[model samples]
Target: MKQGQHKQTDPDPAAHVSAGSLQGYKGLTPALLTKLAKLGISNMQGLLLHMPLRYVDETRITAVRDLRSGEQAQVQGEVVHVEVQYRPRKVLICRLNDQSGQLVLRFLHFYPSQLASLKEGKQIRALGEVRSGFFGWEMVHPQYRVVGDETEVATALTPVYPTTAGLSQAVIRKWIAWALSHADLSDTLPASVSQSLNLPSFAQSLACLHHPAPEADLASLESREHPAWQRLAFEELLAQQLSMRRHYARRKHQGAPALKPSKTLITALLKSLPFALTQAQQKVALEIGRDLEKPYPMQRLLQGDVGSGKTIVAAMAAMQAIEQGWQAAIMAPTEILAEQHYQKMQGWLAPLGIQVAWLAGSQGKKQRREMLAAIADGQAQLVIGTHALFQEQVVFQRLALAIVDEQHRFGVQQRLSLRQKGGQPHQLMMSATPIPRTLSMSYFADLDVSVIDELPPGRTPIVTRLISDARRDEVLERVQDACMQGRQAYWVCPLIEESEALQLQTVTDTYETLQQSFPHLKVGLVHGRMKPAEKQTVMAAFSAGETQLLVATTVIEVGVDVPNASLMVIEHAERMGLSQLHQLRGRVGRGAAKSSCILLYQDGKLSEMARARLKTIYESTDGFVIAQADLAQRGPGEFMGIRQSGVPMLKIADLERDHELLEAARELAERWLETEPVLVDKHLARWLGHAEELVKV
Candidate 1:
């Protein structure tokens, strides 16, 4: 066999057992298999699904004389001269001659084997950008291959695949080609559905994407917008949608405690609140109420912008469960957030004669035991805690509802564990950081989503400003002025302690400096490194108005409600993510008083992305818009904090770019589920290797 070529073999009968089974592949060592596994390629289907990262257009080779400077060109030539020279640097130069002209191939670093392969009279094909070097026309470190004959030159666009260490692109391409030739390429989608959507067959799409014709649209292929690309992207998205629909169907079959909407507690709690619920909140509350009343388990996602009153909506849902003689639990990601929820819930529910209990990792043995007993005995009508609530010792008498705050921070397994505490409980997952529509459709498809689109009445919009740290004294004067007026303020530092490497302001150092600068005002410090107790104490002081200025880190970004704090100064805001900056800005503006947020950054030191993030934060207060921009800038994986392991790894579909296809696929999946439910298993088995595991999200 020639290099980068694989012989076509007959399809193995056992290949039908597993779509991409590697059992039939020959000459693969255990070490190579291990490396391939690390790249998530275990079988023939896996290899086929690994799409090319890019394509090299070598369909028509350009002669040396026809090559233009700054243009990528490929040429077939015979090596005429080869030498190693040490002038300004040690370099190897090989001269090649074609029918029309001669060109020079220069390599700053070359192995002995490479030098040996470039001996005189050897025929080679080189592809690279032509540059005007010291020689007439030179290509530095071009991709070159030894050719047995002129016919071996490529006649189609060459695929460049993503490979792991110890694996070459050629090897991956060869294996993928082999798999393509031998593996079954049967149509997974129904003929009626494909025809309605104007989609090509699976085999046709894969062939076009992996090996396009010489006249294929290079731009379309590169941008992943060609008809063939769309066909594959749609199929991948449909597979995911099918998996989600299946999971949803399975959950719908499970029985859950049908909690009644007891208006007694809900009415009492609402009457006690100083403000009335917003229209959006009322609408979502009704949705949640309806979901809780269903016999089947409710899997719902509640998304609201920061300070959008999600907690009140959650509290209302919990009250319904409590009124129905069942326990309710709320789980938060961090201890601080859990404590905040505990305090808020206690204040709200205690007046209604409903007992609210708190459990945290920081609790002592006696307190933890008491809390656990309260939960198990149903004495604690509503339980609020962190991951400690998921521990084996913590059991609920009848957990009718589980409210998870900051849902993205917790994985699917943690949510499952909490649900398992009792008969499948109606889960209400809350996220203050609004997700883009594309993400919500693909990642949260299994759950019904309700968004709180309106802010409460009498809430003031936060005025955001972008200023340089060079104006530090000006910012400090503003803070002092606000503090003098009896208004609390927050000065957030990105770092807890000053590091010589970063040179950014630290929480501790800023606290000391602010104390020294304004000797009359009290200042408190809080950071992640501080003990839970200490952090809570400092936070309490700030919330109680005992501290006029609080120096802290991002720990105070979420669930810290202080209406009196009208000023927010985020130092080194450029270092923060878009959603995070929005959250920090949300800390203020909760009161009716006019609030201002000052984003402090070092002058002229921001990267393009950082600059764009700060600009977006300054220009927009809409969380959904900010989230969309963040997704576009940082991608879904980083924006969601690497929790993508639970979601399907989409090979071709782009959440940002291919949102239309996602919607189409989702609608199609729903239709198929309603019409041909039996075929879902067969479709998923063909497209998704482990449909059960992939649908857990």
Candidate 2:
């Protein structure tokens, strides 16, 4: 037997064992238990083993004579009067009387059926946490039972679990009770494994978790000091580390033919640039050149904040690939972004007579066929487009490099498809999101990272201002002035159309309003619901200055670039994440003209978190600082919907508190993989299994 477990044998094992298990509760009705497996609960054992999020200590009971202020207690007393308090909301108030004192039992939103259950002048037992008010003692939603049924009044510390709206504490407790009664007490782990780790068996742990007989039993079940959680956490980290290592190893085996850029050609390209590159940019270029010289393909990430000249750096890398007599391709996530990159590349690389062709979803069939032929025949030296570049028909002759824009948007399979073309191409993934160095190292350790921290010359810092609705007219006047100056402007709305729940201002409504405000100006609209061709047409008009003002959704956040656009207005800016806001602001400040971003927010009802986010935006335009602050304000998991990013999901390893643990785990994982490639040892194997389960991969 485990050291601190209950030693007493059941007086009547038959009485202890009950019938209604979770398996039994599955009565052909679709309830939480029916859908439990999808959320990782597999069996009755798994359901009962799910621990409570917190515990409520409803164990304190006292007589009316001993009742004190600011104490939580259950008391038995006679009822005096039942009345209803009607003010902000309806509440049921029952005044109780005892030998020495009186107290009020309050229930928020109590129904008539509840009042019918209790009779005045009848003895009753009240179980509630006490709060001292100005008039007297009050307990809200206190558990009540008949005076004679004292056993039913829960006097022990009760478990309170994380629950959905339809599930309540009583229902969960009943389910747990059912599970405990039907346990089979079978051990899943091998005896040798359990002996080595000195861990409890599967059945034993489950039983203890449901009905902990002692404090030690509860602690052991919680796995707070036990080796179970550590074992689990380690296992999760190891699986990710191993998966990354395997991917890296596989890439290395692809065999990249060594190709070095000609010194004279690279020197000529660098000298011909309009301005000298920043030191940080030069450092990154050198790294890329060095990687190209190696026989192994380069897999690197280029991360920079908004307006950090990342496109220029990418162009230089493509130039090097051209010098090596091999073709290069750049893939953007959207056609708009691809078109933007194509235009930028044409303006910059066309002077050198380097042929560049764009192939996207909207390309003409005959034109696409011709471009594909030129690419396969080694005529087009550089190709830039959306996913069209990765299609099976579009082949590359000796493709040497691939540049992926907005790397997060493309999945691993999509990126691999491009690299696998003709030959495994050297990869450079770029993101405008500035990830913290440590997180980047921990999350993307498999890939090398280069950051651009400097902005190019003549780029003006965008002034961000927060305005209340009272200043709506003033904001509109400013936008009107910016548009009248021959410079274009973008007005971003939160939603495409109206919805019942959100009440947010829609882009269509905003477009109509703005058109009336500026009668002579042409207004173009684009949203996710618009057809691709329609979107392209509107975007093209905006780019060519046919529409001086454009109203758009978040779709334009990443790639539609118009250098002359000097004004950006984002409505309900507080609703956006910091990274999203940064990307939106990046749309402007691409030109020599001064740009200004105005954030319009509702008055008087902003949440604390929303206010903080807006304040952070106003304080600085530094993306790195904003990223760090975002992590601190909302932990990495919640910074931007943890499900979307690959950041490790942790229960106890707080990103803020346990950063040290994260670093330690990273070093341990890397060393273990480097030394012991396979998880040969029993300890490491066990750890790997636990890690994989925790990450839910």
TM-scores for every candidate against the unseen true structure: 0.95, 0.74
lDDT of each: 0.86, 0.71
Off by over 4 Å in 2: 1-34, 42-51, 58-128, 131-158, 163-254, 262-272, 322-326, 351-353, 375-380, 388-400, 420-424, 520-523, 537-541, 544-547, 633-648, 675-697
Scanning candidate 2 in windows of ten residues, the lowest lDDT window is 1-10
Weakest 10 consecutive residues, lDDT, candidate 1? 1-10
Give one digit per residue, the lDDT tens place, for model 1 in 338-392. Answer: 9999899899999899899999989899999999999988899999999999899
Candidate 2 lDDT over 346-461, as tens digits, reads 87777777899889878778998999898999888889999887788888887998999988777656777888884767889898878775556445757788998888778888
Question: Can you tell me which runs of candidate 1 are displaced by over 4 Å?
Answer: 1-20, 497-502, 642-645, 693-697
TM-score of 2: 0.74
